[model samples]
Target: MHNAQPWRFRYHRGSRVFEIRADLERAMPHADPDARGLHIGCGAALLNLRVAAVHEGLHPETLLLPDPADRALVASVGLTGAAAADSGLGALYPAIRQRHSSRFPFDDREIPQPLREALGEAARAEGAALTFPSSWHLDEVLELARESEARNMTDPGGDTDLARWTRLDAASADTTDDGVPYDAFGPRKRGGKSPMRDLAGLREVAGRDAADFERNPQLALLSTPRDHPEDWLRAGQAVERVLLLATLEGLSSSLATQPVEWTDLRWALRDPVSGTGHVQLILRLGYGPEGPGTPRRPASDVLEVLP
Candidate 1:
């Protein structure tokens, strides 16, 4: 999460433009070698900015990966003109604050059809696709998820990124405003894996149960046409958009990127005949009781005021 907010925004009072650029220092080599996560993180922030703009009664237009040489510069968002936020957008605004990654077991009830449609619409508006698989497809994907969990758990550095962000104790001096908090993380169910369980927070995050995790949970996927950094960012913005929509519908969701992060596994997800470029993330969603909120770095910390 920390890797994404590297750019600074400047408002040109006359032109009414907001310029987005990459912040190089926040980039992580080990976790995000190619800057995919970095772009995705920025893309999520960009979506937040767009939502905020609509909330303020304006249309936000974004230009992606504008500069060729300046690879760090991801997107430039400009407000087109004065416009009223739509009712649907207004409906989702409230969920921004309420939306969070829920790792605990969902109620086992399927999400309402209307809500699913709304979520799909949210992705379409942002130039991405959000798909909920059939039971058969879900079973296939779940096996991949299990494989991903096992792979990440076995990888030595996989846990490092998570541990860096997760705060085990509220009063602990190592507390960070970013990363998952212990309270928000559910127990690690034996013989099972949840998209929310990153495995790094196991002992630190209280109430992990191995048994409960073995039960199957609903699964979803986020896909994009290309696999470049720009796509990752766009996918991220869509990610935020869909997640917000889910929260508004009174549902919870978690993300699993391990499988998608690996190169070989990613290509396997694409249909050779259809030639879908790549799968950015695998999501788990359902009508679960909400989980606690994880820490978000303050706007002041992430939002840089340009000189």
Candidate 2:
């Protein structure tokens, strides 16, 4: 959940299949005890793989959780013969590298209606629903986020998880291939009620400036019909699709997952009237500075070649 990048990949050349698996060692036991966040992260990677495949004119036939007995096997993607890929997916390929989780302040400007609808469609394409919360819901969600943050400040386990996954110094940020780096932490929040998580927490980061975030951050909730491993995987893909589309539309985005991490807060995040779906993520999006790109492990480290 904290950019742990908890995933591994195995490619079978003979079968032309790519197997996405969970790297349990990187799982956050405290923040993501049930591994739902881990599945979503793996699912996001799967979506990127699909986008890259489609861009190269290869058809990716994906099967989620193909082996019921192997819970770690998140998905299997079979690469078929060259074919006309979905243009929509291919169009998002450029954004794969462009999209970053912006933790900085977003201007108060509202997103256009057409672009918002397109983002919603992107989530639907990956089997999820995206809704901009009503004013009241937004307040509730924000309050839950603050509560989660406060709890994290006091919880030893949460603090440990945060410290383990965040790079506070410039040297580690430059050398480490995983975790949230100092630069990507963005400026410290001086004022405003934006729900952006302060990855640095109580720790101070040198050279980090303070800024006032938007009073009413443009927030969207991504949800699924059910809460299951399958649903989490779908939610991950849906989130990435929405992000890539938003990137293409000149919007900066970041995830606010604090509220969803807690059981009680998660239930309260649901829309009171509909109460039909399970919320998977809280997304903050608006126009401002794009977050710095975080380090990623080399492909050779995460990908394995198999005969």
Clash pairs (backbone) in predicted model 1: 6-23, 187-207, 187-208, 188-208, 189-209, 189-210, 190-210, 190-211
> Largest lDDT belongs to which candidate?
2
lDDT per residue for candidate 1 within 182-298, as digits (tens), equals 666566655444554454433444454544552557676788887777788889889989988877667778777767767776667664347665788777887776877766557
Candidate 1, which segments miss by more than 4 Å at Cα?
A: 1-8, 84-90, 191-193, 201-211, 271-275
- Runs in model 2 deviating more than 4 A are 84-87
lDDT of 1 at 100: 75
TM value for model 1:
0.87
lDDT of 2 at 185: 88
Can you write out model 2's per-residue Cα lDDT over 63-121, one digit (the tens) per residue? 99999999899999999977464557888999998987888888899999999999999
State model 2's lDDT.
0.90
Judged by whole-model lDDT over C-alpha atoms, candidate 1 comes out at 0.70
**What is residue 184's positional error in candidate 1, in angstroms?**
2.0
